[model samples]
Target chain A: MTTTTATHRGFWYRHPNLRLAGLLSAPMAWLVVVYLGSLAALFITAFWQVDDFTGQIVRTFTLENFQLVFTTPAYLTTVARTLGIALLVTLLCLVIALPLSFFMARVASRRWQPLLIAMVLTPLWASYLVKVYAWRAMLQPESGVLAWLIGPLGLESPGYGFIGIVITLTYLWLPYMILPVYAGFTRLPGSMLDASSDLGAKGWRTFRSVIVPMIFPSVVAGSIFTFSLSLGDYITAQIVGGKLQMLGNVVQQTYVSNLPFAAAVSTIPVVIVLLYLAAVRRSGALENL
Target chain B: MSISRPTKLILTFLALLAFAFIYIPLIVILINSFSTNKSLTWPPSGFTTEWWGRAVDSEGVRDALLTSVIVASAATAVALILGILVSLVIARYRFFGRESISLLIVLPISLPGIVTGIALNNVFTSYLGGLTFLTLVVAHATFCIVVVYNNALARLRRLGGNVEEASADLGAGGWTTFRLVTFPLMKSAIIAGGLLAFGLSFDEIIVTTFTAGPGITTLPIWIYQNLFRPNQAPIVNVVAAALILVSIIPIYVAQRFSSDTNKGGGIL
Candidate 1:
């Protein structure tokens, strides 16, 4: 089991460095007690039965929670809506981030490229809550900036409820797309692009064929990040989607109000995420990186 | 084909428009914070810093802000430590469950925040005891750890094993080698990761909402409650604007550090 370090343990065996061990101890302990333990407890609580009407959980074990979650139309719809919105957001991020990332990588001067990346990265550093708050103010029905600008046109409310949430998520999480895309673009061999141009390939053609294939992994990485994040997020939907419930919201409500059922609903997204990850792993996409 | 000047200008304008789209609401709130009117009417009826004074004077806002600071600081520190350990182990050692461990550490980050929150809530409220400040810290740390670990592990990989070997060869123990060689190498990454963790924990609402019991409101929670206050709601604007103000300095610092690291072209 020790492999390379098995023989070396004798060196550290005599007097264990308390300072180094002390330094490492807290985080290791935290990982065990807080992270792994919490996950275990969460799993166990998910099996507990819940009382109807009052929305309290009982200690008794039952599959009723799972049954309720599977049978409920609202729960299914929320899951569908969550997945749909995440897909839309991922698509939107790709559409916007691709061209911009390409520009940063292929066109911009080396001196200017870092500055531009920093600019794109700024929104990511901003508080998530603040970004959501900003979006809320910008999308208010009457006095919103969009309403002010586009009121005269057919777009009376430019900020559609669920649509606004998707847009805001795209705006906030676009960096995830742009960063990987830019990295992929930067890693593109300068020789290949030159070869394409030398062969009389046009700019768009070169991008569509040569560039896209090379960066497909980055695209996958970015898409996975944005889609999963958007899918799992309940706040943006809760804050901006008005009264509409997404999977996140439903899971949240279940956690706070109905414990067992919420756990069951939560399992759907967890299984889906695990399945996706496994699929990605089986394809060796992550290993390729 | 060579790009024309007008096309360049148009592209620049479009980029600028994108920036504006993201920044306008933030700017509006900043501007509206000084409005004389109670309602958050766009462009403001007139200008006065009355709401700012009110926000500053309010006990609830102050307490919530303080609580947020305490929780964020505690959580970020915890996550930073955890991140260093996990990153070091993964980077330096070959363990049986290494790949799975890596996945587990990153899962909370890549998965939806709602899932993390709900999972944590179920654990804390059920098996664990009351939701105190420590609970919030633990919840925040769960996700925050990924950022630190990612940064640290990437740096560790880039540094390679030679330095540690050399230190040991020169009659240093493992701890000493780590201290003099590895720790110094990873300083900037740790700092960057810590700042990021702090920022994330500070503004995190989803997990905080689930883990925090009633009567212990964080700044985000408070802002959410006050968001639609029927009358005198501009105070919420003022608070939000103030939060933006508080965050800008650290956010800028974080961006600066992360970009510098990116440009340095070593690890990640």
Candidate 2:
């Protein structure tokens, strides 16, 4: 350490830029070459196509991989289905998290707030596979617990398909939704609510007019997690999706047999998230996250 | 805010309902770990400690547990070094492309894990030799670094350069200033960050699935495999119950550091 420090005293001790360069080199090299480079290579690989007749993959740059992704009904439908599920999950999470978050952020006593947040967050640590599997048990038909519980209501388990996927995803990601919304709600000034009410706005009106507008960015921030996560997740869908395949499933399935197509398929989510990030950047929700 | 009794009651009811909804699955998982029913029908037909014993004794569970700990520790160690370096660069420097560097660092996380997983898989298969335990560690460390980076960056931002300058002015060298002054102040934040990173990597399945070789199995992989198998399903609950219990300490530590908005992403 002393020898290294003495050497550092030679040049690094004098030049701040050299010091910065020295400090940044390892991490930058690791992240840029390892992570960003991989992504760039993968995205570029998406453009390479295989010769169907020759049964050979060639790295000729072509739009055919993306063309197939954009044009094929199966690919298009999968994208839509994935996006649809993502949107639905985001919406459902909002519905569940809004009131729950409001309760934590505003309605619940300050003493209970941290506990509530912790309760919401603890599920995250409980292994994603386990939570999805637990839902798998509940969503099982016939002898499933959900069946037993909802049997009296004459509604069976959603039975591990699209609805099952959404429910399980909503369950998995509810905390992601709750926390951002809770933070947003926590950030909302109490005086704003009072001002709204004092201005003769009713509770619903105050919420609609004041709270909703103010909290919308946080909602957007939360939705980014729910939507993007559900979009990319194939595991939950694998456990409980039962014959239903999403875009993630498409990519995973195709990756082994058709790497180029899979890479192309992966780009759809990346593009969607980039666009979503761009949209939410205006909402100022990115910083809130 | 104006509150009505009925509204308060309704909000309270919703909060109670939300808590129940969040907790019921966890409660069921815990109960089923004790339940004698191997097939896992709820209401927990009967209670038994036998599964817990079996789970503890199970070689597969033990091995997978060890594998998860090893992978998480290696990943966290890498994350600790790289995160500190990245944070130091971003916090202390006012150089060209600084913001871009930060964005580059965060992209691994913000991009879908699948993108990251498959991209790394692509590179590993193409150039780095096919997926292995090392690949798994690299993949996990890539994402885990973000937590540590955020926490340390937040700490650096909060602490500023004054203390380091004071040490330097007193004739302490850069290394000395760091070892004696900066490191102690950054220790708790790094611990908080490392804990979050460990937790993230421990539970991670997406990236691990892509990077793990045919022979490797982390705990989540183990859980996924046994989740639905008729005989082993019950034991999964035991493992999960234990994981959840053990994971709390890290989550709590993370929340304690949540005054830093960067760590406010919290358990996610």
Candidate 3:
């Protein structure tokens, strides 16, 4: 019986194409139909406009929504501010992540590495809103933990505003930056560092000339998360940003009432991220992600 | 690779500082959960378990928790099936557009959450009629696919096809080989992937915000709504504190499974 079953291959099993199709069809249909279709629909809707009186989306193709997004001073400022915030958050994460990741990857004993990585990763599983809320509590004007800590030092907490938003975002994304950079550090050969030192390079010189250049791809990979997350965050801004608004805030506010305009606003991040992805794809960072 | 003593000490101090930065707010959340102050002011005037008791009894909390569990389970189920299917093809066969398939899976997650959120929101409102429970599941599963895919793909690549071939050569049929060999080998990976996907879907807020219909409150949405209300702030803290404590289990379990394979670090 076993020999007969093994010798008699099913028709579907005899053909690799059929097998592949059987496995591939369901996932492909869902991804292409639901995900890609929606994205395409969103961008298409961006070119359309809304009627003034009926509060309805007009199907006619026009550049009015894009024009408003690009030409209006408020929208332009929001775009620039969002870009600036994303950049600042990325920079802050890189600064904090580098030494921390280096320590974990190189300096810590092998036994301690996994524990430290776990420490960094645990916060990621913590609820996002809860983390932001924690930051909100920490940044309360005169009576917050930060204020209390900095009070004796004569440095005031930056209250809830642009600075608060940057700090919170940096905190939220630091683990992402650390994990990739840590992986890069572990991948770096100790022989390379020894060779640099043996060639008479000082610590700073070796770090600048050898280390940073080698891990640049990892840095870029980490920056992708920091930049894009900050660019598209509204809740963080809502909780800690006080009066400041980013592109996501604009999108969220307008999406319900003026979807075409919101879709136009949404395109800003999409274009920026696509451009960023294209630029970094050459760096081989996409694979790291 | 030899570092000076001072430099090593400085690195250690900085690492400690970074850990503190990562953990301080969570510590604060824990403390505030017990604070008697209604507004959760720091340096609590007193300590009480009043909020914890209230949270245990809150109807809103119970309903939202149930909804979150259901949505996450449903999303994780869909993601596991889709992820396993895609990973099987990508790992077992070489094909055209393979890179594009990986890119398509990553795009849902790699893009900003708000972009994914608004894009799906637009489609649902205009074409699908309106956001509903199903829409929420679809949005979540779309992104959760990547988590499962990455874990499964890593395991499948490491596993290779030799075992399956050996099983077939021993007179097992195709389905029998898959069931006895491939399925058993990939079970741990699938569990790891499912746990991670569940955690992701459970905590998701941005996409949930856009995709969840009116009156369909998930845990994160519940936390968001009550976060600002004066009377609910303490209970919110209790819930958040409980979440931070409970989240450690799945993360630790997933870590154990992935580490057993020793293929990648922390499931990315």
Candidate 4:
């Protein structure tokens, strides 16, 4: 009986395509049908308009939503602000992550690497809302932590606005930047640095030419997280943004009353991310991610 | 790699500053959780555990906690099965559109969360009846699949096919080889992935906000709702402090089981 069962199973296993199909079908169905299908539905909805009087989504294809998103000054400014914030956050994360990751990967002793990495990663596990809330507490203009710490220096907290949002976002996404860049640093060949120094290249020259070029993909990988996350974040803005708005804030606000317009606003980020991904694909950053 | 003394000192200082930056807010949450002040004023006026006790006894907290746990567990389970299946195919078989499959797996996560949230929200409300617990699960599992898939794929690739070939060379059938060999080897990876998926699901807020039906409040949603309520603010701090404290365990465990020196576990 065992031999017969083994023969039957072996026969099925001999056909790799059958085995592949068996393995691939369920996950593919979920991904293509549910995930991709939803995204397509969303983009399709962008070309739709909501009837003003009836407040129903008109199924007819129209460029009105896209036009409103592009043409309205308020909407256009929101898009530009969101893009600026994402870029600033990504740049801040890079600046902060480069040194921190360098310290962890190169300056720190090997025995301490895992512990240091763990320390950086611990904050990531903290609830996102909680972290943003914490930032709220920290940024409370007059009596907040920032004011308490920096008041003696004649500097005040930026006080829950554009600067505050950027700071909080940079802090939030810094770990995402650090880990990949740290990995890149670890993968960097020590010999290359040694050769560069031996060839009389100064520290800045070696860093700019050799280190930057090699770790560029990892930096881009980290930037993807910072950029997209900042672009899509409404909660942070809501909690600490005061009167400031981003693309996500608009989407969240309009999603209920004007989903078509919301969908159109959302496409801006989607298009930006896709274009960013396509541009960075040449750097092989997607694989790094 | 070759650094001057000044550069090394500067890097070290910057790294410590970064660490401080990362941790100060969490520490603030911890401190404020015990503060007698309701507004969370700096220096905290005085320390007390009354909020902790209140949080422990809060019915809303309990219900939200239970809901989050259930949703996370279900999502993790679904993600585990899908992750294993997809990773097995990608790792073991050379097929057409293999690269595309990997990209497809990543798409749900790589895009901004708001896009994903609204997209799924549109579908759930329009075509799928309405948002429900099941909708939350599906939405979460979609993104959670990538975490598990990456871990499983890494482990499967490292495992190679030689062991399975050896098992087949013996009298073992395909199912037997998988049950007795492949599954066992992949167990740690699956656990690490599941832990990660659970974490992702548990902490998810943006997508959860869209997909969760009325009356279904996950922990993060609970925190968000309560964060602004003056009377509940201190309790919110207590919960946030508790989350930061409790999160260390799974992260540490995942790091240990992740086994890859280069990747530093599921965090990536």
Candidate 5:
């Protein structure tokens, strides 16, 4: 039998906001405990010195970890290489995604639009490791399809190291980049583009003035994904790059090697990404994206 | 000279070419799953079902797939429950620190997976204890909860308070109203949210890698180790193809549902 809900029965109900606040408390606690607190804990560990034998950290804090991160050639090069890869990946995503997304937004038939969108997002659901492994197989020296296909073009060993890894990363992250761009383009006022053409502006000029401003936020969002994914990828570089250590690999190694110094190196990118997000939010790009 | 039909034709071809660029590699992987190559040879020398058989029989692969399923499902269910509760509170009431709370939830996802892995690993080892599948589920659910929360919260905000007021005025009880009105309306969003969460959790490797420790190896870990093995190439392809199949279903369903609602001037 249905019972009428007692209105304002409990002390907590005296203030509805307090009751609502209580309901929100669980998720907030999780955010604090897991997201914010873990980072704080990791940051503190970066300052602690590691014991030689036991592989335990000493309570005594020092700036030596930070110093080692700066001085070490391996750590520094890995950081540089990771940044380079991130930049390249972002550029590649932008180049390919911009036109494709624009076409999807502007040209596709209404019935086909959802299908196209689904096609773009399908890859995001695939098992990440399996996707990477698929690439590794596809990039194999003698047998990979690339080796066979590009043979006529005179490029020997099509899928060996850096190029192979870069190609794979581009393929995997392309969807992420395209989604935001598509969203941006879809939200644009179509009448403005019509007016631009009506005013006798050429296609390219109209695109520059009308399209770019609207889609800029999408580029930022897509760039964030491509850059951060590339920056944080150790497995892709390790597996596909054939044991090549990127910044992500360095972090893994440092954690595995029990090197407090290397651990400190990993902390740098976290700060960089967080700061980047903060800046984007401040710039009002978050809402646009 | 100003505008040519040939140029328009070329642009259309180029657009189709872009789709080919996106789809061809994946199609190759799918096609190769049925190839008879001992290694990953191109344009297969022959055809066979042997790899699919091998994929089924391999203990390591079998165990890994099982582990992956368990982890993904558990993470999804937990995150969905939490997402509904949190979204309800956020949508219905104004609270202090709401923006900051939302940011905290969203921030973990913005940072790359590796950083999250390291941070979670640091916490588990230093503050908690020996890592297990449970811990991996927890780590995965953290980010996944945010996604589900976003989807459900957006839906909840649109629903508003009229339904509850109507139910109460009609003499329906709190539990009855929630079950009949609020819960039924939330069903589709929750399904969408759950599907999204499942895809994410199933594919999640970075977070799982950190928390899995020594004992647990999921399908990703299994595939990772055997990626370059010449003998296992066919089996790997079969497994990879299977993974692709598994991942695409949920995304396709969700996208179709979401798009349908949008066309209907937003879902209730």
Candidate 6:
């Protein structure tokens, strides 16, 4: 009885295309049309002008929004500041992640590596708002723990400003950096390190020659997360950035009143990331996704 | 392969420092939840359970928690179905755009989430009526699919086609082979992926902020609102400390399912 049903269904399944289509239809409809189409639709909206008086989108086509994004010094500064912060965060994460991930991947006892990785991952489950707010409390100029800890040392908390935003964001995204770099380090063969040092190379020399090149792609892979995440983050800036604003804050502020203009500013980060992704595609970093 | 003693010592010291940096804020949160001082003063003026008691009785916290659970569950369910379907297609069949599909799957996560949020917001507000609970689910499911796809795809690539072929040779139909054979093999990956998807959706704020309706409040959204208010800050800490505690089991279970062999694989 089952044999008969199997043979019957086998006739339709003989064609791989039909089977593929059957599997692909739902996901495709959801992803291609709903996800990609929405993105395309958004960019289309960016080409139109918003009516200033009515605060509504005007359907007529214009490049004025993009022009304003390019021409306006305030928007340009936001772009630079955002780009600067993203780069700094990525650099700091690399510096911190390399040493820690190296320890976990190579030096830690095999029995404990998984446990450490799990420990690293647990913080991710904590609420994002809570982490940012915790930082806000910690950097609270007068009453923050940071101030209390450092005041006797004749220093102050960076105190709810650009530096605070940097510290908070780096903390928030640290695990993302560590995970990939650790994975990269684990992939390294121990013999390669031995090979370099055996041939008269010192620690720093072998590290520069053997390790950095191998892990560069992974660093880029981690950067994709930290960079893009920082670019889009307005919440951290809102909480600890004092009066500082990023492109994200600008977009959020103008989203309702000037959708077209906000969309244009958003294109800056999107284009920059797309370009970065394209540059790193050769390294096969996208495959790491 | 081994470093000098000094280098090893330095690495270990830095590792400890990194762990401390990761954990201190969390400890502060745990402490602040019990702080008697409402203003979040340094060293905590006093310790009490009053905030935790208030949080337990708070109607808004309960309602927001329920909403977050519902949304995350729906998003996870959607992501699992779509992830499996997509993974099966790519893993089993050689289609025209096979390589590009992986890129497509990753696009949601690779793009800055704000871009994704506003893009979806654009579509929802422009054509699909105002943002609602469904829109939020859709936005979350988009990124959640990547975690599920990665887990399932890696497993499928490992499993290859032999078992499925053996089942087919024995006269098992596509549906029968899947139900009896492939599904069991893929179960762990799916569970790990689903937990990951659920976790992502549960804590997500940027995308949720854009797609959620005016009255809809997920826990993160609730935290964002309350953390900014002076009086509500302690209550928010209670909720956060509680969140960290409650979240451990799902993460532990997920770690068990996927195991350690995968090597630094992130679910999201």
lDDT assessment of candidate 1: 0.75
Interface RMSD of 2: 1.8
Top of the candidates by TM-score: 4
Cα error, candidate 4, residue B223 (Å) = 0.8
TM-score of model 1 (CA atoms): 0.89
Q: What tens-digit string does per-residue lDDT give for candidate 6 at B1-268?
A: 8789999999999999999988888888888889998877888878999899999999999999999999999999999999999999888887689988878898887777788899999999989889999999999999999889878877788889999999989977888899999999988888988998898899889999999988999999998888779888878889988987877877888778865325344436
Q: Tens-digit lDDT track for model 3 on A11-115?
A: 656888888898999999999999999999999989988899999989999999988888899989999999999999999999999999999999999999879
Estimate TM-scores for all models: 0.89, 0.95, 0.97, 0.98, 0.92, 0.97
Give lDDT tens digits, candidate 1, residues A1-289. Answer: 3544644644464534543455456765776677777666667777887677766668887888777766888777777888888889999989887767766776667999868876766667667877787777677788776677677786765464788888888977887787777888898888888888889887678878888888887777777777777877777876778887778777776566676777777777777777777776644345422
Error in Å for residue A34 of model 1: 2.3
Better of 2 and 6 by lDDT: 6
Ranked by DockQ, the better of candidates 2 and 6 is: 6
lDDT of 4 by residue, B27-54 (tens): 9999999999998689799989999999
Give the clash count for model 2.
Answer: 0
The CAPRI class of candidate 1 is: acceptable
Question: Ten-residue segment with the worst summed lDDT in candidate 5 chain A?
Answer: A1-10
**How would you encode candidate 4's per-residue C-alpha lDDT over A143-183 as one tens digit per residue?**
99989999999999889999999999998888889888988
* Candidate 1 wrong stretches, greater than 4 Å: A1-10, A13-29, A53-62, A282-289, B1-14, B255-260, B263-268
lDDT of 5 by residue, A142-252 (tens): 767777777779876656577767877887788778887877878888888888888888888887887887677778877777777787788888778875678777777
lDDT for A132 in candidate 6 is: 90
Comparison by TM-score, 2 against 4, better one? 4
Please state the error at residue B257 of candidate 5 in Å: 4.1
Q: Indicate whether candidate 4 or candidate 6 has the larger TM-score.
A: 4
> Of the candidates numbered 1 and 2, which has the greater TM-score value?
2
lDDT at position B197, candidate 6:
86
Binned by DockQ into CAPRI classes (incorrect, acceptable, medium, high), candidate 3 is medium
For model 3, which pairs clash? none
